[model samples]
Target chain A: MAEIAWREALNQALAEEMERDANVFLMGEEVARYDGAYKVSQGLLAKFGSARVVDTPISELGFAGLGVGAALVGLRPVIEMMTWNFAVLAMDQIVHNAAKVRQMSGGQLRCPIVFRGPNGAGGRLAAQHSQSLEANYAHFPGLKVVAPSTPADAKGLLKASIRDDNPIVFLEAELLYGVKGEVPPGELLLPLGQASLKREGSDCTLITWSRMYYHAEEAARQLEAEGIHVDLLDLRTLKPLDEAAILTSVRKTNRAVIVEEGWSFCGVGAQLVDLIQSQAFDDLDAPVQRVTGLDVNRSYAAVLEHAAEVNPARIVAAVKQVLYREEG
Target chain B: MAPAYPKDLVLRFFRSMYLIRRFEERAAQAYGQGKINGFCHLYIGQEAVAVGVNEAVQPRDYLITAYRDHGYALARGADVGMVMAELFGRGTGYSKGKGGSMHIYDIEHNVLGGYGIVGGQIPLAAGTAFAARYRNDDRITVCYFGDAAANQGSFHETLNMAAKWSLPVIFLCENNRYGMGTAMTRVSAVAKVARRAVAYDMRAESVDGHDVLKVYETVKDCAAWCRSGKGPVLLEADTYRYRGHSMSDAATYRSKEEVEAERKSDPIPRLRAWAVSAQLATEAEFDALEAEVKATVDEAVKFADASPEPPVEELWTDHLVEPGERDVPPRERVRGVKVDWPRYPSGQELRVKWDLEPRIPVQDGEPHLKKPA
Candidate 1:
């Protein structure tokens, strides 16, 4: 095991996978000579050479579609979007080609490609740059969506994603790149669709993933100080959500609070709420509370931007409301 | 210069073009008879482009095109029976009835697909070429799109990337003059589609699409240029589609005189006249070849008509590779055992277990780091 940043863990995973499989290559805008927009792919070009780590022109739809075509053949391509925000231009390839090829071709083709990059808000980037689009991607059936909060999970989940024989939309949090954690040495492939329990409690359950998991953890600490302990669940993968872990936590606490960095309406939290109410309805003592980003375009001002988003304070308040300590 | 193709090869080109013309006519008839359903775009007048290009490239080379693709598929050697079965929405189709006229894919023949979206295949062609280069292979990818597709954002983006990476791809624009009903003059600032290639510093040319030999020679040279690592080239074939955009189109945008003028240059009769004039084959030989192609089309139609529709059980399949493992079927109630909390060791504990010093100690109440203000 070794301590590394989340970005380093992702880089390590790419280097290791590229080294393992000759067919596995990386392509995207600035992934090679530029060493990745956020430097998640730093040193890969030097380590793997240009053929394996390719730099492409600023053509999201083009390169993304190209990656799908390559995947249709026998190549395992890791396509890096500068950010998930820029990936909007390539939604047709992602939604129509990569996602539907296997089914449309009746198992004749399998697009084993991974489209990864930093996702969700990063400071006051604002509007186009700060959108959290995990739900929109997870809404599609053929895609495997995974967002890891820690460096270990980032390395493990990415390795698994690269190996999985399906199109995966791996959403990495920009804000969590510098966050440090211990990653296991050698090949450590974490299973997708399994939720991790960050903390143990019975008063209330906090469900979140990716960057929001940190906020939910902090909220758990605050609730513990107030003599009301809560369970913190990190939903590592969104599409094949760890529903058993969620129901387990909600059933034990009889109260739940969901946190997300995306907009309130039709967000991942909304789907969680539906799952909880439908599955754990008999065990609930109070209505599930959701803390999500305000439904508006992200602001340019730092203060307004912070106010419009989900944070530890919001998670704490939502947990308190679910526990009946604060009014809804 | 005249193409130096052999007598047999020239006859084959004529036969290929006629096959496409007759296949498309039958397809349109099938649509009218309610045998084939959904958006069917006939390649009536543009048979030479598909046949000429396919003949120029080797079998190992890749080909992709837009929705008006029965000609491209037939030209690329996709089985006529399977292609017709796909149009009939039968289980024996190339895509097993899931993809109709718009999405015919044949992996074995290296025909990537007949994409529905205009210009959608451009980027995919670039990527396929990138794969060939990555694998150190010598195969080139040929992409075909209509004139209207040249104005799409993907066309510009793909051309830039293909040139930048020096990928082995040939971008062929079938300039059918109209994007559905909209005239090319109204949509494009530049008159010629090949002129757009200069923006990417790539070599480009325009050719007479109705002339099979011209298209064959141009595509042959361009495909060779790409395969020899000269980078991507754009070739705009000035072709025309005699039929409407889709079966639903009334085609009131153009006058009858314009249609008549285009018909004067119909590729099939032109090829037959050339073959006879050049002494490649006599009128009797041309008639015999036409009869042979007609019989082939008839056999394909019979095969497709006899093929069964995909079973209802097939509807739930193919949407995913491992459906059972991924899809959690809906249940009446919440199932599965409750997972215990603290499922794994904490990050701090892991650091100690792995004998590594903590980079950033885990602490409570510390504000998360935000990007520089």
Candidate 2:
């Protein structure tokens, strides 16, 4: 096992996967010669050559559609969006073409590709750059969504995602890149739809994913000191939901708190709460509480931005509210 | 110089146009009977454009068109029954009934796909041509779109790219004069859509789309030029649609007399007259070919009626990669710009697991493996 930053783990996974598969090529702005906008593609161009490590023009729609067409003709292309924000320029390709091609073809063709980049709010990137689009992608069924919280999970999950037969939207937080953890060595393929238990507890179940999972874990650690045994579950894949794991945890703890870095309205957290209620309604000790960002766009002010999104304090408070609430 | 395409080819082109006309008429009937659903864009009067351009290319050449694409598909050699079944949402239909009339794609036949978005396939078609040239293939690609698509950004981008790279592609604009409800006059300030190609430094030509021979001669020359690596060309075939934009359309924008006036110069009768007046074919031969085409149409309708709907299990099928069939290379870097698989530390076999399939072996110092699963 090697301890490295989350960003390095992602880069390692990408490098390892590229080394493992010949068809696995990377393309994006500054992804090749410049070593990627985030350094995730560092040393890739030096190793892969230009044909595989393609540095494309700033036309996202053109390149995205080009990648989709290439994938249709038998090439596993790993497209790196500069960020989830700029991906909107290529939304037509992803939503109308890439995501729908397989289903639209009635399974005659499969887009075995991955679209990855930084997602959700981090630091003071301001309104346009900072936004969580997991729900936006998860709204579509044909796509598989993966948002990893830890370095090990990022690398393992990325390897699994890159190799998956379906089109995967891999959402990584920009702030989580430098965060480190121990990653198991060698070729590892983590299965999708499996929630990892970050921490075990008996009083309440805290369900979250991506950057929010860290907040949930931190809150769980803080709650443990206060004698509130909070269960922290990291939902790596959002679409598949890992309902069995979520329900099982909810059944045990009987109290649930869902956290997300996205807006509350129709957010991934809301979907989890719905799942908990429907799957384990009678098992709940109180109403399921949710910790999510404000529905408005993320502001640039440091204090306002910090308060706008889900954090450990909010998650802990939500857990406390859920654990102490009375049912109607 | 134009290749001496025999009388039989012209007759076949006529029959194809006739088949498209009849098939669409039958589709209108089916829509009335509630058999076909969704947006049904008919290619009534614009049949000649598809037949003429499709005739200029070989089966190995790539073909793509916009939403108004049934005639293009039939002209490019898509099976009639499959086209019909696609409309019926049957399992055997093109796209497995996933895409109705607009999105027919048969990669084996080299018909990339019929795009619903206008001008969306332009860049894709250029990319296909680029791939062919990169692979040193001599084949050319034909990208068909409406006159309205000329205003799209992809049109400018594709034309510029094709000219700069000298990719073998033919951009055929079937100017039926209307883009949905808006006439070309209302949308385009400059009426000569073909002239737009000159902006990319590529050759541009406009032909009488009402005359199949004119369309054929023009496209064949341009296609030849592209095949010789001279670069892409644009052909604007000024045609007209006899029917509304789609089945549900009232066609309130255009008058019936205008449609009838355009039909007076229809390519079918004009070609038949030449085939007879020039003694290229006998009246009997023309009759026989038309009858044969009618029989094929009858068989297609019956085949579509008899074909089963897509199997329920197939709903989630074909849309993604089928497990166990891995031919697309792994997306990774090998050495520099070229992406190859990892090499085992020399003299040792580097076995790597890609997905659910068996472990693949990579040579020492080699970036790729023996094969995908």
Candidate 3:
């Protein structure tokens, strides 16, 4: 197995899926001639030709709705939004139309569609470009939300999302796209709703996903030096939450800390904290702590940006705080 | 090919219209008697739109529509009793009582479910056309909606996509002048819905929906254009609904005089006049046809009334997918995901466990189940 960047892994998955399926097609603003805004769809236009790799107008709502419509009729369409922030423009179609089509049609129609692109805090992209809407999307029931951290997970989850019978929101972290990992060759499909144990420990449980999984691992290593063992859980699929895995981890450690890139209030991290409290209340030895991005948008300056969001240092502090409370 | 409709064909169209009118009237009565529940949109004054349009398309072509769908289903050859049972939420219904009056689907006939939300069926119809093209089928889609839906975002979006891709679909807008309690004049600045088709650069026209011959000929021409791969077309059937929007409608949106005026120009009587003038049928023959239609509707009602209500156990039958069934399996998933031989979970009992960590990988060294050559 050779190591490849997360973005390249995504590209390979698209190429493989397209080669295998005649009905699978791609559509987005820069997906065709320009390769892709993020270059994840690079080399696809040349390989699949124009019919499959379609370049759409800047009409997000129109094309997204059209993708849903096409999915209903039998075409498996992978729609790439330039960024997750832009998906808000088409939220009506994604939420009301695509997500609910199967249930509302009384099971008459099923949308085998995927909406994927860059998401979460990506460097200093600022307010409009850098935002995680996973919590907002996960609020809806019929939708499946997937956020992949590693290159292998990116390729496998994207392939699985495309193949799924239901509509899926595949949220790719912009910061993690260039990160590299070993991906099994040929074809692979990682199942949705299964969390991965990024690192094992005993003293406390650190639950996170996407780019934050890396931060959680870093914090866990630092705490291991301080004699505080931390178990890191990467929630590959946010919607399904992998409740069994999370509760099991919480039950084992009696202490929990949730981390997310979005603002803490009503964010996906907050939802996790609630789930832990409800499921493993008796097992918890200390109040659950959380490390999340600030409520305001990220500032352009490096200093302000660093203070605006959670990082490895903040995660370590939160874990330490939970452990100290457990001792007290 | 442009020859005048034969006597038999003309008589058949007349009979279909009469059947729809009588059936809808009976349905309204049933609703009044508390037999039918939920929303019931009648097609009392819109008979020609269904008859004329159905005559244009082939049996294999796809058909989709909005909530005003009783006439369209009847025109598409859905069993009258089955449709009535659907309205009554019975087991023998087309959707097994899952879909009511506003939503009826027949996959075998390619009649997609009627949508409740205004203008929702527009994009779905385009998708159906896309599928037809992908399969290399000559079948075209005929999507019917109202003038109100023409103002919806889906209408514009679907039209643009259909035009850009040259999908084989015909957007049939039955401009019945009202959407529920609101009049067209109140909602849209430009009352003519057909003119909006120019935005999509699709071929479009306004036809007198009251004239069955006109609607039939126009839809036939449009259907031909779509079948020939010339892309989508728009046919605005300018019709009117004699009854209120639904069974509960008071119809205060328009005056009684307007209703009377439209009734005077009713499609059935106009067609009957031509049939008689052309010596296609006598007054006695027309009366006999009307009597036959009433008897057919009466028989349908009896059949529906006698039909047993859907059993409670069957309510959940079509609600969810079974264990082995996936709605639409992506091509790659079916072909790419490899499997090994005979490792299927054995026996009646099955147990599953949740792991905090990723589960152990199954070995791939075993001989894979090979497909028979």
State the C-alpha lDDT per candidate.
Answer: 0.84, 0.77, 0.80
CAPRI class of candidate 1: acceptable
Tell me what TM-score chain A of model 1 achieves. Answer: 0.98
Per-candidate total of colliding backbone pairs: 1, 35, 0
Model 3 lDDT tens row, B1-373: 1457788888888999998999898889889988888999999989999999888889888898889888998877767877787787765666655577888765545667678878877877877786666556688999999999988887887888777777889899999999888989897987788777777667777789999988899899889878877778877888999999988888997999999999998999999998888777888989999999899889878876776776677544433233366433111121243322111121122121211112123236621111111
lDDT per residue for candidate 1 within A1-328, as digits (tens), equals 6799998999999988887777788888888888888898899887877677877777789889989988877678899999999999999999988998777655566788999998999987989999999999989978999988999999999998988878999999989999999987878899988999989999999899999999888878877888988888999999789999999999999999988899989998999999999999999999999999999999999988988999888888878777768633
Which regions of candidate 1 fall more than 4 Å away from where they truly are? B1-4, B323-373
Over A56-80, each residue of candidate 2 has an lDDT whose tens digit, in order, gives: 6776776677677656655567899
Off by over 4 Å in 2: A325-328, B1-3, B126-140, B153-168, B198-205, B221-232, B311-322, B325-373
- Docking quality class, candidate 2: acceptable
Cα error, residue A297 of model 2, in Å, equals: 1.7
Number of the predicted model whose DockQ against the real structure is largest:
2
Candidate 3 residue A88 C-alpha distance from true site, Å: 3.0
Which 10 consecutive positions of candidate 2 chain B have the poorest summed lDDT?
Answer: B327-336
- For candidate 2, the TM-score is 0.87
